[model samples]
Target: MRFSRAIATAVATAALAGSAAVCVPASAATPSTVAINAGGSAISASGTSYSADKGNIGGRTSTTTVASGTTDSALYQSVRYGMSGYSIPVTNGTYDVTLKMVENYWSAAGKRVFDVSAEGSAALSDLDPFQIAGGKNKAAQRTFTTTVKDGKLDLAFKADQDNASIAAILITPKTTATPAPAPAPAVGINAGGSAISASGTSYSADKGNIGGRTSTTTVASGTTDSALYQSVRYGMSGYSIPVTNGTYDVTLKMVENYWSAAGKRVFDVSAEGSAALSDLDPFQIAGGKNKAAQRTFTTTVKDGKLDLAFKADQDNASIAAILI
Candidate 1:
């Protein structure tokens, strides 16, 4: 959305440099008139349908006729005398498109002037009046490059002259590169030395140690490792953790590991506090020790806080928070 005139100028320069050869192919010889609508409705002939006889005034060696009645209804207001145009697909890069008009006939007292415009802006005008021998054909060439956004590129030409001809119209893509996308707002928890907080104020968490400890018999301390403490697990009573308010798709995975000698531990997992963890039921974890339980829940938080708890009838076995 940020428009930079300088960036557009740079793109135009690069495209012209790289596409010169492609635009003037040896096989391209003296510009020939291709079907004005060959590319699609996006490109067309404006005045008097592009005619090979219009003579190429632009540097482009190719030209086309728009036919007298083929003028676009929408662009009719922008055209006068005999005008026609062609459209080309413009990528998000820069481009340099040139059109050449040729004067076939001129009157001793009449002025022969031609103007060029992009979309509709008449920024390109004739350098001077085109002069041709009375009743004889003469050619003049003009070149100009403009930057276009990603989409269809429309070029229109109009002339105020008694008689004119077009030899060729040329459009070339000069260079292309992927533009970087915009950045998103930063959002995440912050850790300060030995102190963990949901706020992203600073970073100071203890380097080699876990900031907080949890009951090993239940959710062992250091069991979870994440920039956010939401990964840590707690016993069935479910423990509260701090979180910034925002829409979040919360995921919970429970792992119960109990050897035959450790006995079975029955447990259930749920979220609570700011939002009822039970409301996210289907996402509840239920099972016995040595078995893994998983649940996923999505909810919107407006109170900048998230509390999660787990309940278990235990004496020896326990469950660990696998992930959050």
Candidate 2:
């Protein structure tokens, strides 16, 4: 995921300045439904005129005609005009681009009606059309990732089909960043089980092993076994773990078990206990017939803590909780 390092730093500076943080408008395309002409710079159809409604982004519609033969390729022709072309100013960064083909139609006899390409020196050139079932409208999507120096982005699409219709094209920008590895917490084990805790006095959890198995080192507290009630609680019954105020993407891993639930387990998740956290609800697991489930959740940290809870709905299903 691409995150604005400058934005991250600015948020910290805002706290020192004792002022409301100014949000940087992340680079993105505003939502607007507009259609581009196909041939020149205007929408014109021969056997059938292309409707602007169909060409709007997210609502891809194309103009089509009822004609059969290798040479009957005259359906719609025009250069998409007046519609604004994207002139995105990008700095040195990685970006993800996606083109959504909302609507496409072709006759039973496969014929190449149109070709779409995103044009730029950084542009990728090989967007091959996958085989479509004959005689029906088809939809597909293409994606590309590229890095850019300071420059403007120019995306272009061209059509070559005889009686082809196009819906709308959509483009979005995403940042790419390398993540740092997490620091492993310390674990202390006794004859009963083990206890895991962080560097400071902020977070702690106690976990017990089943059948006298050696306890493993982990980050959070709580286990999937009903016989165990580890003490790795990050918050009180209704609070969440407090983090150092900053923007962060937090992830947690946990174990799931269905063996104790009389062969079936079901559960729902709830997050509470911290106000400094956002994006609380993480996951749900339904256990069935002696199966165990393990899963993780990712959330955005806004203030200082992240709190989470899981409630089972099975006869003996349970989950082990861990926080990163």
Candidate 3:
């Protein structure tokens, strides 16, 4: 499947910002040797059986290791030109994943392209090593954190414009604590915008590093009724709030602080694709600029998540706060 251009842009932007965005926690990375291989039998020259690459003999490429932390230079040839990564044993918990690669083939970009997904979430979209490393025969390392829940943390390399290849896969434990079966009452960000902690909640679409998943644009704590106002998140068009399968009252705290005039700010809000609010205008509801307004709608969240999708008419959509 193809990657969403919007999500790809969001992730690429975050990567350039050195934030890893929703892909990883902001902590020092230390990847242990989970598995590594070039292409062949599940054995390396150094006799590292656990780290051999499950290979597609037809797609094997010859490459030399740069001698950084690699165990076997010849063992780095096990390329998964076909098939997804699940040959190793894994458990539920946070992990530091490091995909080691050196340009063994292809001199320029677009020669090799693939999509990477970890634990059913997009880690990298339209990945091209030649582009990431600037050229072939060079070394490049892509690191991120992923949590395994279903016995094994699946890392799939789906063919994009071209085949996906990996010289080796390194997975290291992040923390000693076991992954929680279910998180606490999902982060219902209170008023007054501040940086959203990555450890807070699992996000989708609009959910980002700063604001659940995306960075929050505004924090309304003291300007108006500080008691009523809180932090607000705005960025992409779609967002998902993680929650257990159940029904709950979803409240929206709206403010006409940004757009002063009517029709200047118009958008649609939906829950599970059903129209909850059509052509919602905060300025109209609040009656004037810098006024506070709110609306509430109750809906059931199936699949352990509540999707909040927005579409703008005149300007971008916003959320001052959400209370569950």
Candidate 4:
């Protein structure tokens, strides 16, 4: 028996600069059905094209079953036996796989027992087709829902008693994944303030205080200022940003509003006592005063926090925000 395929629509939304956009994929392909004639020759039936003995080439048994399926179809007349099964080509996604079987040579349960797996995941174990179909030479079926992302569907059979056999195969496309859930808050800091929170992330500047830093200062004209960049700090002191011990992407949000050129406010930055940004100058990156500059680097933090220290070279160092 065959089942109809139905797909569910998914949607995702992204916000940038106070505006939103909706996006979707190019749409997935229809389900692919590959019917294989287990041990027999190939022929199409019931509007489905059948492949002949594509897998387990040398493991085939030439013996034809004296018993025949009551359905009186060519597919029910022959079958193949093997220790391992086949690998069918497919696209990346979830699918529904159906295997058709008929107990031919083995009329007893334990005479031909085996296990089945789909793409390395367990599908069935200790399978006894003869027992499942009520002890005889009859037709039976097993179905499983699985995901295929590595470009193929592997139907593997490991024999426990004698060997495993199959008569036909049916594959159909299953529903795709829906949009992911909203992300958690990010971690960040407002230079002189206690903690700044936004976009599912939190920022803080309350680990160790750096001298010459003011919590009530404002940015200069033409400089970046928002909820995340409201406060400003200037000095040549070391400041530690509290964060869980691990590797993180660190971003230093700054502006050269106080200086007109690169060499005026050069500073060396270190995270966890390691040099991350050496001789970094916002004016050099943005090319002028009152322009914003952002520097990003990766570092490892230990002992439940990250330590960020700044050493001034030519002039005093300044920062508006720190994001992790």
Question: Considering every candidate listed, which one attains the maximal TM-score?
Answer: 4
Candidate 2 residues 139-185, lDDT tens each? 33345765444454455444343422333333334533456556434
Model 3: lDDT of residue 311: 80
Tens-digit per-residue lDDT, 133-214, candidate 4: 4335666677789988777788788889887877777777775557755543456667766676645567665445467565
Give lDDT tens digits, candidate 3, residues 103-205. Answer: 5667655677778888788887766765555446544557888887655667767877666777767677787667645433644544335433322432222
**Native-referenced Cα lDDT, model 2:** 0.35
Candidate-wise lDDT, in order? 0.39, 0.35, 0.60, 0.68
TM-score of candidate 4 versus the correct structure, residues matched by position: 0.43
Error of 2 at 291 (Å): 8.9
| The best candidate in terms of lDDT | 4
Ranking by TM-score: 4, 3, 2, 1
Off by over 4 Å in 2: 1-93, 97-171, 174-239, 246-250, 258-263, 272-303
List per-candidate RMSD values in Å: 28.3, 20.3, 23.6, 27.1
TM-score of each: 0.27, 0.29, 0.38, 0.43
TM-score, model 3 to reference: 0.38
- Name the runs in model 3 displaced over 4 angstroms: 1-33, 38-50, 55-78, 176-324
Candidate 1 deviant stretches above 4 angstroms: 1-81, 107-110, 127-129, 132-136, 160-165, 175-324
- Give, for candidate 2, the lowest lDDT window spanning 10 residues: 278-287
Q: What is the lDDT of residue 121 in candidate 1?
A: 66
